[model samples]
Target: MADYLPRAPWTQRDDLHRMVDALGNAPDGTSLARWVGGAVRDGLLGEDAADVDCATPLKPQDVMARLKRAGIRTVPTGIDHGTVTALLPGGKVEITTLRRDVSTDGRRATVEYASEWRDDAARRDFTINALYADPRTLEIYDYFGGLADLAVRRVRFIGDARQRIREDHLRILRYYRFQARFGSALDSEAEEACAELAAMLKGLSRERVAMELLNLLGLPDPSDTLLRMEQRGVLGVVLPEVQRPAIEALPTLIGAERQAGLAPQAIRRMAALLPLSPQVAEGVAARLRLSRAQRDRLACVAGRQADDAANPLALAYRCGTECAQDRLLLCGGDPAPLSDWEIPQLPLKGGEIVQRGIKAGPEVARILRAVEARWISEGFPDRERVLRLLEAELPA
Candidate 1:
């Protein structure tokens, strides 16, 4: 299948050609670099790849020194793992020496450089990720039936599914994410291995877990994959806070987001997967090690309730535009009101209320609060309406 494979259009770029040329050739006169991993995988799928990584037989220092000779900047992003970052005119390309895993823990691998491309391919997590392409000929090299699996839209582990997951627990999450992004159905063998190794996820850093979950949630529709995770007892392991109610709530939230034309958001989805208790939400967000703003958003979504009968404008005004939208969507209310409309501030000021017969004291604050509530409840009408509200509250 690889032989019949034609060139990837993106490989024809001048910048990419320059990067390959800078890597030079081996003593055998063969090209030292080939485009590896996601770039090749996505190119075959006819979608643009976000990253274009390189594989070479040269050592890490050699990769760096050669790029340095060509006046190309390089960073030893993962030097120990034989990886370097090449800054090109178009974008950053990762250049790593061909390597085989010398040893493996659930977290990381110690690698030794290998001269053969197939040996390097053996260490990768998935079959689809192991494909490579020549920078010059643009011919794809599929070592482990990657093109076959990809043709069928199947995400398969390279060798043994359990062995692969044991090498890195993160691949468990990655399996689900890739399945959601590319596959029509989960690979049963891969799913079974992931389920068996689910407990290993607790060993991974919360930040890593959070990142993968968020990436999954950021997809167009991750509800099915998440449900599968819950069914397999994986979601409960990672996020014990997620209950059946949350499991049921996510599809509704996703539907509301689509109906309201709001983009899928990770934090909001995370909020939906927890009970509507601010304290529980706060604990979950903290456990995920989410950023301060994200934590606050989750807590707000949980803490505040959205009233479907309440005016959308007033909700957006009172709870803030973003939080209100999240709350509304979560609590079965309409979130579409703020889609085009900006939240407006209260039109009347305390000074205006005081200028009416109300004295400059706490009385002024009380009257303003009543008038502002009226203003907001009345769909935040113009100052003309606010003036009448202030008049009615004045000294009576």
Candidate 2:
């Protein structure tokens, strides 16, 4: 029900008040600081905003000096970029000076501070993100039609869509991400602009692209937005390795994940969007510059084919609990056995087998492996039963 004003509880916290109070001694607290960007946008939606950022007309150094004079602790997090972080008792607030982009190269932008609030808002990517709130006035400021856009769940570019994208190609990915999280549907103009300039995405770093795509995949159900991206050729521009068949298989995995009471993971969903081939998964993972652990996990689930009736606990012991769940859900296998089962290490050892009168050589190792295999096949029996099984492996 918040409109034209933000009623976020974090704004009323005493720590935040202390931080803002340090910014200025104005009677109404104007001309000092106002909450900006995601905090304001999410707050107005009746959601608890985790990150509370602010904008001030004062330069970063001056703001730091003021905070220090008021006994406030400040970190020069991005001082060169006109951003300073004020540590409050409740949380840290990122205080950035109002700035306008001086130039952009479709990757990074050079910015210069400006006194006018609108100048700062103009440089933002989307209208809904341009919302701002004055701490003292208790009034929300909409330089663009952000409030109206929020009302209709529409995400529109601040100015020309193509120009906004040209300024930074990352906006194309951001548009889809925002649409998946906030907007009820895709904006045709924004979608078309992204398609027209989709090639510019090649200019971005692989890390950034992977981050956005993984974030999108992490959503509960991004099937519609993903399908739109595929239709628009936007997804293909970044990840051509994902063929249509694999992408189509995502919904089934999503449903299986839901039925099995498991949360959707970004990497798991990404693994679902590829053929069941470890080689293919490894190749795509390397291209995206994924971390070693992530690359290995993708490989683990990619080549695996889980039977619906297979022992999920055994699979968990083999690859990992997470990988087992992923393979089962992706392959239409049941993972209920892992719900309460605790994976146990083999109780019998090679030394125990050697003491059973077997030669202390290759045959002992072979017997130990055979006994371990039998133990696993029997669903991991007690230590006594394992010893008996090892006795059976020894030469008579």
Candidate 3:
């Protein structure tokens, strides 16, 4: 495996080199650590990976002691889970001792640290994620058929898919998320397992579910995966409020997004994938425990009506370019001219309304709204024309 595996970019960094040099051998004469999980998986796929996690056979305390003795900083990020974070100069790497699941209640797992790498790999969710790379030798250790799976871009769960889902229901969603990024086809066994356990998703926290769902939605085009989720009844359990019509609109909306050169936005994509009425959006926000910003964005995009986006300038004035363009995409209309549309501020100031002998209370606001509507309706006429329109709307 070492002969075929290319050295990942992170392996060349000085910090990783020193970390490897410092912990090459453990106290019990076991090999110290091997780069594992996403870092190894992505490197083999020829993608630049940010997180570099490692697996070690040493106990947590011994792992800490070795790093400390070698003058490396250590953080007990998940000590009870046999995990330690080694902070290096250029970056940080998470190193966890081998562990086997002792018990699981769907949402949480209890584990006992073990020295066997196979036990660690067995506990992982997917075959690709179980691949390990020796930092010292650049050799990939594939206890499972991870190398074969990666070669064909398959995203299958390790062991019995149903049993894995029973341990952590979140893997149900994770199955789709990983597929959205790396897989070409869904495994029938994994799909059946996920479908059977779809209802169990509610046991997971709203925040965790939201984060994973949003990650899935953030892919360049998640239409196919989303459709599969819908077919398997997963979407009905997760978001019953979403209708088939909204899900059907995704391909066109995604096509519009690509044509307009717009980046994938999770919230906007979410909006495109559901009925964006206030009540439904509110339900989504509450169910997902969305943040204030996320709630507001969803609400704002949901509040838009079809007529509001009919005109480019009016859309720009009311919703801003991004929001209006998203609406246009949702409507299956071209939004290329949006770039040429500029949002113009109301030419008349509040003081001007007051100066016109109008009381400075709600009357002033009323007159400004009236005048701005006239300005928008008239295609944002010049300031003088706007003033004349304002003159007629105010007290004679």
lDDT agreement with native, every candidate: 0.85, 0.86, 0.84
The digit string of per-residue lDDT tens for model 2 on 19-123 reads: 788888445537488888898888878888979899998999999999999888999999999999999888899999999999999999999999889999999
Best by TM-score: 2
- Give the alpha carbon lDDT tens digit for every residue of 1-396 in model 3: 143447766778888878777776767654578889998898888888879998888788987887898899999999988889999887888988899999999999999988788999999999999998878667788888988888888899999999999999999999999998999855889999999989999889999999999999999878888888998899888888777777777888777788888888898988776675867887798889999777767766787776764686677678777777777777666678777777778888999888878878999999899999989889999999998998889886
- TM-score of candidate 3 relative to the true fold: 0.90
The model with the greatest lDDT is 2
Worst 10 residues of 2 by lDDT: 1-10
Candidate 1 structure, TM-score to reference: 0.91
Per-residue lDDT of 192-239 in model 1, one digit per residue for the tens? Answer: 999888999999999999999999998988888888899889999998
Better of 1 and 3 by lDDT: 1
Model 2: which residue pairs collide? none
Candidate 3, residue 331: Cα displacement in angstroms equals: 1.6
Can you rank all candidates by TM-score, best first? Answer: 2, 1, 3
What lDDT, from 0 to 1, does candidate 1 have?
Answer: 0.85
lDDT of 3: 0.84
